[model samples]
Target: MTDITSTELKQRQSAGNAPTIIDVRETWENEEGRIEGSQNIPLGTLPDKLDELEALKDQEIVVHCKGGGRSASAKAFLVQHGFKNVRNLLGGFQGYQQA
Candidate 1:
């Protein structure tokens, strides 16, 4: 899967060309804060929610979690399921906050 840094994601967002950001963290974690416009689909529920992402199969998707683990797993799952343009946000939201 592809990887994108938080800084790069920020630039893309500022340019209004950001890819769809998917947060794979759990509901509790998401209550803290999330990147604006990100869609929350907990890692555990991703498989059942594949339909929600059907239309975005060909579009760019950036996935993240509290750290990088869940996002990596989610990205791999998406690719295996035929998502052509998926990425994992390295270091996840923690990395984003640092940037």
Candidate 2:
């Protein structure tokens, strides 16, 4: 799996090559604040939501949580499910905010 820093993500976004962002934080956490255009699918629901993301299998998918841990797990899960390009957003939402 690849590790993407928030700054790199922002740069890619500005370049019009942004990857699909999947937020793994819970509802409440997401309600507070999140990166624009990110999809909220909490880690717990990822298994069930995998089908919804089938179209992204061959695309670059970047996963994030409040912190890095959960997103790492989420990335692993996607890789196991045959996602060709999955990445963990290093430092997650907090890092994005800082960026």
lDDT of 2 by residue, 20-96 (tens): 99999998999999888898999999999988999999999999998899999999999999998999999889989
Deviating ranges (above 4 Å) for candidate 2 = none
Q: Highest TM-score: which candidate?
A: 1
Q: Which stretches of candidate 1 lie over 4 Å from their true place?
A: none
lDDT of 1 by residue, 7-97 (tens): 9999999999999999999988999999988999999999999998999999999999988999999999999999999999988999999
lDDT value, residue 63 of candidate 2: 94
Candidate 1 lDDT trough over 10 residues, lowest sum: 1-10
lDDT of 2 at 84: 89
